[model samples]
Target: MKHQSSEYVVVIGGGFSGLATAGLLAASGHRVTLLEMQDSLGGRAGRLHRDGFSFDTGPSWYLMPEVIEHWFKLMGTSTTVELDLVDLEVGYRTWFQGHPDPLDMTTGPGAVAAFESVQTGAGVALEKYLAYAETSYGLALEHFLYDGFSSVRSLLNPRLPALLPRLAPLLSRSLDSFVAQRFSDPRLRQILGYPAVFLGSSPKHTPALYHLMSHLDLTQGVKYPLGGFAKLVDAMAELCTKAGVKIVTGATAEGIDTVQTGRHTRVDSVRWSDSRGETHRLDASVVVGAADLHHIESRLLPRKLRSSSDAAWKRRDPGPSAVLICLGIRGKLPKLLHHNLLFTQDWDENFGRIRRGEPLDTETSIYVCMPSATDPGVAPAGHENLFMLIPAPTLPEWGTGGADGNGSEQVEAVADAALAQLAAWAGIPDLAERIVVRQTFGPGDFVNNVNAWRGGALGLAHTLGQSAFFRPANRSAKVEGLHYAGSSVRPGVGVPMCLISAEITAKAVNGIKDLGPFSMDGQNRDAREPEGDVQEERVAK
Candidate 1:
């Protein structure tokens, strides 16, 4: 962990990826400066306080514990000591449209029995599917997750031709078809299928390969940081500081300046605007775009320096945008758990409307996270902190009751409808009256606050073509000393994936080996360690 004075690395965006990237680079001996546009360090993971209610406005569920452990280990710290982790006994509860009782799922393996109770043979089906899912998860971790996609060749191998026969099933079918073929109960299907929306795609469109999420969902189990996602973000920042990474918040990187150094034009400095609107410049040998990749490219760099044209980005399918509502209720929500999924009867129809850029229909699916159920401190005593998310398409216009769709003002309308539906489904008739505080974020807000492209919550869809090496490359072939990370890059989406993305990007930018053959063949790590090391020669195909 020796510091190198010769090279300086400028990491853009102080989000999870930026923090991780800067920390790793600093450990590897590069002078690191992390610039964040917002006033805080955590980008989407930042907290919002309204009327004494605390909210993790973006990510709520902390699914992959191994990723977090591996992250701290890389930083030479203990995750357990730095952050408190708790297993959510009831991982989540589902209020399906027709089901008489809300389905309660636990964090441990006991959830199999619960699924079986819904449908006679569902428990067996779930076990069998998890077995297959585990193998796919191993393959994905081996081939995709750990490495930076520097080139198209990263996605190919000699064994790919052989695996084409085995890949037929996954490549041909959607996640909907994969689970629907195995499970008979509609409730079970919705329960399994609903996670695809978290990745910004519906099960009907998401690739079957993403079934690996099921392995994380039921088998690996859901856990959380005791306080909130803010605690986890704080832990990451603390680790970054200890690793000697300089964090610069309230400073926006406006443009990346490059100089021709032999065969390539290398990024040498960055021009940024500070909180007081004062402009500053920092020189660096390497530049990492930890912010919105498209925004960094189109907004910061000249058109000639950008790797992808505007049309090329439009060609890629941006994932779903969300209409979010954060609330503080006066009384407890007895009918709700820490996590609640309000599934609609017309699930497919809901997805269809969103895909068409239409607003959420009357009978729409809403994901409600009641943090107060898990921690009382998030809200006032005897009160509740509630965060609701509705998946809507990223339309051109966002406003209340516009011809195109509903705007930010329409949040109350939608929240009222969602409350009425929740109360009816959960037998809590007085759910609407308990609200003491409320705030809403629409597509326009995402555009303004986060520089989100078309207000997309997640970067890109994990469709078959959009995933793997088909995504934007980490290393820039057109520009030297430039890299990209976060949801938009390969091994896409999720908070945990961002950690891996930063590791791979740092490896690429810092001129490290990047575990090339090591990650695929699992030749570097010991056999006993089972977090992500894949021992077999199986990767692609």
Candidate 2:
């Protein structure tokens, strides 16, 4: 049966990905309704406030500002309206326990010189490696990321024949192996491979394509909106509303209403519950499940329409879940940057424990976000907003190794130990004493907040076998009108990638061309553009 092109679209999840997809669809002159179970938006990257301090609970750092710019521009909105984007100077710091000096990464020549000083010829090796990363970046941006990935044929396109060779180099070997091949110095290797933790995978499992993150940060630069990461969310949500999209927060989708006729199953409506405990069923021509893909398929959809357990989404390639300790400090640490990393002595063993669902090392590596150093407004005067993340196992059986029996208590204990160790490593005295406010989200929190199966923080780990075309498809093979986006879906994790996931899903539903080249958002990905006409004013909060 033929249908109207301007059919009403309902997005089940209202995270960055869902919101972005709805925005893109609305911009295209389609009626888009976004349903968010939570009271507020931003999902994993949501915000929290206690006393006079404000905390960016999820998505502490904003990498690749250009990707964000391209998104806003696609919606015909200027970035200046929602955020005051600024480039961070001190890239980050890496401490190797007993080293005489801390590895502080500056913007350009200084960083190159620092690497050269650490290892005899690492600067040259880094140059070559970065060149390769740039090639991979261009290839990924132009061919793999921006397009709608449905079948293997999409990747093996005759129009983009050059992709095969580049794809090999990008996904050929492990990022750890690539780093080891390039840099002889262990410290240099650690610094380069450190960011892999954010991808929610061990260095050995993550593909070399992720090495492009180096170029994105060092060359392209790390940026932050004047507000927190939430500013981008606000901006995107505003675009969706201006494009005539309706956003309903605190609305939980309970079930799907479908009609089956012979071979086809058609989605007729959606059953949902709001924060007020009222239930409503709305008719929808097509449904985009922007939440976790696993949840949508396994839990949200009926059993008959679901696929059997696949290794990629099941036991194998499961990503590491994180336990984040977000703190609003009373004062700033003098040596920290907008972004910094405190490395543990044994990263291999650390990942090993996490892979097996064990407690992380007390001296575990921590990614610290100090936005207050760049933009003072994030915290109160003379204070800082910090997020300390320790990636650990999501297994329910993972006990606290004596720190309160259960994983939550264990997470807090380990986080406390991590902060103490961080203070010693960075030479910051009484670091824990200065904390005026603290909030934490462990693997347990991840499950409760987003219905992330098994409390997996980011979706599936970006292992070599589960990359690009290998990842789950945007459109569900089980359900005709149901689509998937966000971290779990292709292209991968992170705020930018989540946005790209939305774009890909939108294109799959509307049969429109995906948005143009965007800077990487979320994990590794291309998000959707706003659907209809871009609007300037803010939506009703």
Please give the CA lDDT of all the candidate structures: 0.78, 0.74
Listed in order, each prediction's TM-score against the native is: 0.91, 0.90
Question: lDDT tens digits, residues 1-541, model 1?
Answer: 2222335788999888888888777666566788898888777775788777889988998887888787788777777888888778888998888776888987445778888888887888888888888888877776668766565455466556776775678867999999899997778888889888878788998989888888887888888787899988888898888766778888888888899877879987888888887888887778999888889889989999999998898788788887777777888778899999988888788889988887678768989999889888799898999888888788636643211223355655666677677778888787777767777777766777778788887778888777777778776767898988888886688898888888788667545564431121212112122325221211111
Consecutive 10-residue window with the lowest summed lDDT within model 2: 519-528
Q: Can you tell me which runs of candidate 1 are displaced by over 4 Å?
A: 1-6, 156-163, 400-407, 516-541
The positional error of residue 414 in candidate 2, measured at the CA in angstroms, is 1.3
The worst-scoring run of ten residues by lDDT in candidate 1 lies at: 517-526
Question: Superposing every Cα of model 2 onto the true structure, what RMSD results?
Answer: 5.7
Q: How many residue pairs clash in each candidate?
A: 3, 27
* Top-lDDT candidate index: 1
